[model samples]
Target: MACGPEGDFARSCVPSITTSGHRVTLLTDDGVRIEAAHTPRIPGPEGPYAPSRAPFPAPSADLAVVLAHGFSGSLERPALRRTAAALSQHADVITFSFRGHGGSGGRSTVGDREIHDLTAAVRWARSLGHRTIATVGFSMGGSVVLRQAALHGRRAAVAGPGEHGERTDAWPDAVVAVSAPARWYYRGTAPMRRLHWVVTRPTGRLVSRLGLRTRIHPEEWAAIPLSPTEAVPLIAPTPLLLVHGDRDPYFPVDHPRMLWAAADPATAELWLEPGFGHAENAAGPELLDRIGRWIARRARRTD
Candidate 1:
């Protein structure tokens, strides 16, 4: 259901308009259909909207931030919307549902093949005429964004055509990973152990589907994809930011520290926030604002 005056009016009068942004369908490399939105920043303190293609960036907008939600989170989630709202203050924002989440197709591969989803979103942002792009990911998404940036790199030789024939530049000018795990198969914390069960067991997968609305793929990772620590070293020349709450329950500060140690000091920055919790839900407006400013500054500098 739509909330607030604008969303309610749009829902009642214009049934097709549910969100405060333009709805888009992104096709990943593996042919999964990813649901997405383009939220153009407006003046004052309010949510964003891009009613038509002609007024995408408005006059002030130049950069785009692609937000990747965590394991169970979706583009439609309230927390994710708030994150978009906060980031849209500085740039246009693109938020998308990973496979098996929200309205997207296919099953979630946790963090493995989800890189394709992030890559598709990045390419969509680039196609929207934003020469500069930044990616911000939370939890599982954080790991995916790190791997995506490493795989594509900023200096990718070809602007190759994607599955849909759209020109693809899967790399971003800057990246921010919040509450991401440094290495895979980490079952150190209580939450991590529960998460492992959710992905590895049949009953837990059923609970995830029925209770959380997040569909999990039952098969194990055929091949271990690149870990976040391994990916960090490859992200130099493109600015990277790793943010982890000191009180984060899932993965401790060691995760971010491991990633930071792997990254080039000149290009990578780590923020161990005080009293902050995990991912999108724990990120308040003030923290999001700071993140938006940080990315905006870094993107401009790198450009």
Candidate 2:
């Protein structure tokens, strides 16, 4: 059977595999309700191996990856669904709609509060009994993953118990950020200029609501949060992979380079693709397969 709209997987292309997937709604710490889908990995014969663009240490089994979509994008986007389908070859996949997009509730704070959205998804993945969990995000979601890793990784490392006396640690074991920006309030490119207008201007906000079905928050960020580059250093020990396209019209090569420079080289790997453009839109089957293999290898590692 075909996958459901919310990514409920009844059957898959691999004939010998039988795994179940379902739609779930996650409540963020801040109380926003986010829409998500969970698809367990289908165990079967392996497909062609795609070598990693960059070399890294091998890894754990039964890995789970949480996919965060970009601004104005939803879990229903074809590109994201294709990515989820491709990734399911190697691991269980969970895709979620950030607030202000798709079926999720609340207005977009652009990238600021989205960290909570990722946190909720990561927590859900952990609750599923997957010992190894990774988060893969694109564009705005990429920024969210970096910040989430930085913020929650530290908390999870030292946190004791919650208000309900349950452990509050919800950080992922690994993180992959694609086409993420190095800093906030960037308007270097025409697309970003337009995006700024969409998020900050009244008319543009209306257009976003009507044309894009995205509801952006009207107020400016009360205070500047930790930039993606700055957040990189805090994600140490946890493996990190930064992927960017040289031809990207959004943030350009400097963004990823800055992020790589800020990250600890021993624990981070950066891949600068020549022809790729942006996030999921630029992630083709070959790229996705390569990423899947890389993540699978990382998940298998004990250290």
Candidate 3:
């Protein structure tokens, strides 16, 4: 269902979440969750998303951080943990494996279906009353974050500096994309030609074929799906921080460089990490501090 002028989405339209927290929850008429998690890590040693959470960042901050994992990746990646730790200072953090990835249910839809899951997740966070939300995604997850920000993240309507589409109604205050692939998969890009089979194609087919919730759902890019370069226009004027490694194996280093070039410049920002390659396990302390402070402008600087 489309978001109404009132922004109240119907509950029947919302997707279900496999692992939320200690308790199982109900849905609303808007198809969104009114409350996601009361605590960061759920009770007991059996917590699935808990152990992956940061100890000091306390997942109860005012702002809600939604961290997304990349292809075949889980919520346990070191980068997500590090990012979550840094984010803990200002908001309650929410990190989940996408539908088909980790302990979550459903199949990966590449960008097509994943966007819905992300939308639902964002709506769930909004219901928590955090008032502000931000996202950080790795690799493909970076694409997810950018889409959500362009479609619904905070800075969707920055207006004049760049060429953001007017259709944007939802958004995060700020967006961080770590090693984002500006060129999408499936339709045809250097990454797809090189990385799709191991990274995308097979996974997409598996998601659709298995009907199981662990695969990434396939996205038909040639259709209406937004390409990475196209999304930059929507993020215009909204703060965009992109991190790409110079030595990334999957895609060329020029990918981010081209992305930065294609971007309108007056608003978006890009950071190409020289030594870090691809979706890294750890971001240096300097990068960590930069991310932490960057998230602070919109979230809360509680930490």
Worst ten-residue run, lDDT, model 2? 8-17
* lDDT for 138 (candidate 2): 98
TM-score comparison, 1 vs 2, better candidate:
1
Top TM-score prediction, candidate number = 1
Q: Which residue pairs clash within candidate 2?
A: 59-300, 59-301, 60-299, 60-300, 60-301
lDDT of 2 by residue, 127-218 (tens): 66677888999999999999888877744457554322433487778889999999998999999999998888999999999999999988
Better of 1 and 3 by lDDT: 1
Candidate 1 Cα outliers beyond 4 Å, as residue runs = 1-19, 44-61, 155-168
Summarize candidate 1's per-residue lDDT along 1-303 as a digit string, tens digits. Answer: 222332222121111233465666666767777888888765455645444445233443378999999999999899999999889888889899999999888999999989888987887676667788999999999999898888786644253542234333567899999999999999999999999999999999999999999999989989898899998998888999999999899999999999999999999999999999999999989899999999989988977
lDDT of all predictions: 0.83, 0.80, 0.58
Candidate 3 or 2, higher TM-score = 2
lDDT of 2 at 49: 34
TM-score attained by model 3: 0.68
- The per-residue C-alpha lDDT of model 1 at residue 110 equals 96
Q: Number of the top candidate by lDDT?
A: 1
RMSD of 2: 7.9
